[model samples]
Target: MSRIAVVTLVLHFYMAITVSTFANQTGRPNVLVIMVDDLGYGDLASFGAKDMRTPHIDRLMSEGMRFNEFYANCCVCSPTRAALLSGRYPEMVGIPGVVRTQPESNYGYLTPDSVMLPELFQKAGYHTTLIGKWHLGLAKPNRPNQRGFDEFLGFLGDMMDDYWTHLRLGNNYMRRNEEVIDPEGHATDLFTQWSIQSLEKREADGKPFFQYLAYNAPHFPIQPPEDWHERVKAREKNADPARVKNIAFVEHLDDGIGQVLSALDKLGLSENTIVVFTSDNGGKMKYGASNGALRSDKTHVYEGGIKVPTCVRWPGKIRAGQETSFTALTMDILPTLGDLCGVPLETEIEGRSFKPVLLEGKQAAFTEPVFHMWLQNGTKEAMREGDWKLVRDNPGDPFELYNLKNDPFEKVDLANEQPERLERMVRVLMVHMEKAQKIPWKRPEAQANVNH
Candidate 1:
């Protein structure tokens, strides 16, 4: 009614708008990506494992959304990790197979120009840290610190020969940002501890962080603590010895996960952090791992090898106890995180964001054909578009077609019955292969010579 009152009201409105804008910019959610190595689809209690217990992982799943049709970009380790961080097909980034410490055995070399996920986050004012397996590269220009992460504390090699010893081929690849250090304790426990420490330090700094906590557990050499192994054996009297070891190993890893999640809760970061749990590939069946009813196991182009259990939890944002059958590859995670964090990806990438699926609880319709390849053991490859899948188990082998919607287990082959569909899919696969051929998977000759 008065001039002073009207001006005062306008000033209040302007201040409110400014404060809201500042909050939107500074209140970006923290991201924690927990990736396990060679975990099976049917390995956890929540996913349908009757023999194994994973209360921590199951609880996280119950608090978030589960992706039933999630897949690794490849059937192996390095490639899928490469695809995940770079938001591109592994082959496009010079990683179609494993990256080993041995020069002759290494199959992938991360190109220097590829923009990693952490780099994008760092540009968006987030502190990036990687506290686990750095299988992408062992040396400069590709290592975690060299790429983007502000902190790196983990194993640099592909796999450790012994979890307690933390050595690969008698050489230590464990490092704290380029400095090799031999830390005592099991690898799982050490990683878990380091992750919590990082979170605590970051919390003190009062900045959002993107942490990738990777664990190499339930993998080969199925080593669990004696107590855990004994507990499993005591509980499952009729289970095989190998199965008992695997179950114990997984349960121990689950406990470490619980510790990490508990730390988040105590730190009061759970409400604003986005927690993601997934595996690089499927389980190695011979090592007492199960892929539910999926056909085949790791290293093969089947549901078991490529498909993985994936879930995301963001309190107050993603609804709890939800699941979706949206078929998505691991590469999609980068773009999805970018979308959620309000980061714009300036460079081109093949991964499409699935943000709508996470927030809306709906399957995002994806028509793009997803392709997979592993250039080892005869170059197994596969492609899927919608519900139809085309798989070539080896080089020079006839492609088998399957309607995954009907025969998810790949019990009956529809190759002969659907010749036209098979041919069309093959053509698409050939085009992808042609593009992949242009990218060199091996390190440059000079770089290889230097490493050797």
Candidate 2:
């Protein structure tokens, strides 16, 4: 062949490679974040739950990397949600605890100041939608639309009424943004249906989407469909009547998730879309949630309270049937999605990207120490840095330290023997607290009276 003809062929091959690389880089992947409320670490078969059936969620675990040390920033709902969305510590976000009541204007709520995951995605040419409980804030300036989401369909309070009644903020109504009205079906069913509809709409528009399916199921007011309750009760003969009802509630929730997953498959979105399943915090022990090897339940700093069930699935990209004991946090979700979707982070992100572990099965990338604190009303109630944990009632109280690595359940305390380690942990905790802008503890009026 002539030299010019061979050179032309080589140029075409190089151009093809360049175009293929550019297409791969520009392909915006869809993100589906499925967050369950108050599910414990041991609630799934893959996570070691023996009795209850979470086969669908377990399927996610079998098809994705499951993190054993995954944790919510708070043992409760509001703070954890704030931290997850903002990619910052809860204390930094000014949400000390759950926002149960409609508070004054000065009170903290999810506002425009927060840079939410959906907002980032929307800016990067992705449609953003939410279909489930949004307990962040109910007031005017704190709604999901005001914060980031372009399409919002969920309640705006910390908790809601029964699935049959669907009362939120004193009545049974589903909000299309800030407005509210009664929905035609159960909460779980409605959320799933809306999510599927949104997915379809986005697909038709030829734009990728970031969906936040935040279900309020299995949290409290544990009431399930009668038939589901019957099935659970029949299976666990010795279960408490009320606890059985709770199990049925979770089971029905699982069914709702099944519908969503089924929709993804039917629409052929599963292969391209990333699906993540996780809970806000630990489960209610009194309601019969098995926290596996951990002790205590929601509201405490114990493993059973903070550690939650977590699983992620992305076909063709993330390896299937994998489980790792590496530590992770809810804060990691934002950065992971950001990295995958090519959304350039506007500010510093607290969570590290677990993409390496998910795609390549690399374990060493998750060696960073995840810091944690639960301070309500400006008092450091609990703190965890790496393996050592410390809990205190007040400023005057001595720190109660535990080695979580040795005692995952936090049953033993070695504070007396490990003075050096305790001191080091305390110093590190103080530094983090200061950096995160944690408020100093102010004694309650009753405490002052007692002191006087």
What are the TM-scores, per candidate, against the unseen true structure? 0.93, 0.87
Residue 225's lDDT within candidate 2 is: 72
Model 2, span 250-308: residue lDDT tens: 87888888888888888867877899888888998887676888888887766788888
Worst 10 residues of 1 by lDDT: 442-451
Q: Global lDDT of each model?
A: 0.92, 0.76
The candidate scoring highest on TM-score is 1
Cα lDDT over the full model 2: 0.76
Off by over 4 Å in 1: 1-25, 446-452
Best by lDDT: 1
